[model samples]
Target: MSLPFNNTCRFNSVFAGVLCTAALSIAPVAFADDGSEASRERALVIVTSDSLETQSMAMILSRAMQEQGSDLHLLLCDGAGDLAVEGYASERTVAPRDIKPEGLLATMMNDGAKVDVCAIYLPNSEYEQDDLREGVGVAMPGPMAEMMRDPKIPVYTF
Candidate 1:
């Protein structure tokens, strides 16, 4: 017999939590660099989701990785591209947490993390580089391609 829909949803929620926990636990170990040429502690975070939860998680994770000596690059595309716009208001994702994703992104920038929106974002959205917040750039194809080809750097997507 099939379980009720709500029960199935609950089960899925629990499963997703388990997966998130497992992924977090494994992330550092899997990406740690032992000062080796082949394994540098660098990360590329590609965020295509504009949803508050997803962007918040990406920002949080990227900051954590930076704290661990990983150089981080945040590439925003699709819905997430809106995040790079200057003075863009962000919806709060976590309760009892005042900082929104936009604030977190600023903090990350202050920490020297690179932020880039897809090159097409501006043209397609009728935006220009000057329309973005300071320090945010358009992701050029050449550098983006190079980043992807660097096997030593791991990528996290949200």
Candidate 2:
């Protein structure tokens, strides 16, 4: 017996998730720094959530990491990509400092964070590459996947 087309797709997605989780679990751990040499921690922060609180928290945590000397590569997808769009402002402000996600994003970029939107963002959205703020780039899947698979560079998704 075979699953219906939609059911097959759902099954494939779930199976792929399980395999990826298993592979990650077995991948050898690589510390960001070794006593013999000095190296900053590298991280890939992927934010695809549309929720305001989620977006805010992602940026907050990323900022914390950067201040600690970690090298950050931000991959903004879905609605979160708007944070890179020039002249775009978030609706609500977050607590503790009363800054929105876009504000934190700007601060990180100023501090030399590498920020990029998923390549599909521009084509699907009403924005163009020119719409993005200076220093922001579009992420290509090949390079983004290489970052994700690098054991030394941990991936954090929200």
Candidate 3:
């Protein structure tokens, strides 16, 4: 005894199998999360700046990094600490071309980037805790150092 099917039914079954195989072959590539090239290109940026030009450049770089879906973390030290403090940045500087570091820090925070000021700098300087601008967090040297050590974390100092 033999099982038999019409030519039309045989064609339909073969076509259906081909469609199923094609769909399966294409589905994984479409939905797989194997850490593609785009994901591998993601990075962490650490900006340390005490100069007005450096601070301004850091802000621009942070904005561009965020636009490209990279992570940015800023550590303010030395005179850069002044950037994290309120009013000091604005009141102390009158350079005609100087970009207010405080404002740049604020914009960075608003963009979901993390801004950290050296804890040692906070108390030694005249800035009070409240004087530290909004969205600025305090970090000790150790963690900042560790972050800088990561090969994937690019450090820019100015």
Candidate 4:
């Protein structure tokens, strides 16, 4: 006997097919390992902001890179140096609000990520050596400039 004329079944079947196709398309990106991403080897992220949101996004990206087993180096230069200042805190409540730079520095250090502050920016700032949070290192502009030139290193400036 033939099936009843239920157009709903045809629609449901088509919908299911579309869902399966979408799932297949996305599954590889979601579950695939980072070993195949050649660019994941080394990454450099530059944060030039003291903004909460910018710092937060940088931290999140750094964490993701580390999770993928990439060597991550974060450079804080220009206005971003404010983040490395000890006791620096922002009271702003907004979309770009993020953990204090000092806090992010500590977290990144704990996660085996390197945190560097531009020396050129340092001398001009009010931050003394003692003002910098622990586990953060000094990076001269020369070295940072060179690192930024490396083709393999992906630079994200904020």
TM-score, each model?
Answer: 0.72, 0.75, 0.62, 0.65
Clashing pairs in 3: none
Tell me the spans in candidate 4 whose CA falls farther than 4 Å from its real position: 1-40, 92-101
Q: Which candidate achieves the best lDDT against the true structure?
A: 2
Which pairs of residues collide in model 1? none
lDDT of each: 0.87, 0.91, 0.70, 0.76
Candidate 1 C-alpha lDDT tens digits along 10-92: 99999999999999999999977677634547899999997888888888888889888787899999888888999988755
56 Cα displacement, candidate 1 (Å) = 0.5
lDDT of 4 by residue, 70-117 (tens): 878888888777777777775753345434555656777787788888
Predictions: Cα RMSD each: 13.8, 13.9, 9.5, 9.2
The top-ranked prediction according to TM-score is: 2
User: Is 2 or 3 the stronger prediction by TM-score?
Assistant: 2
lDDT of 2: 0.91
Worst 10 residues of 4 by lDDT: 93-102
Model 1, position 127, has a per-residue lDDT of 79
Q: Candidate 4 has what TM-score?
A: 0.65
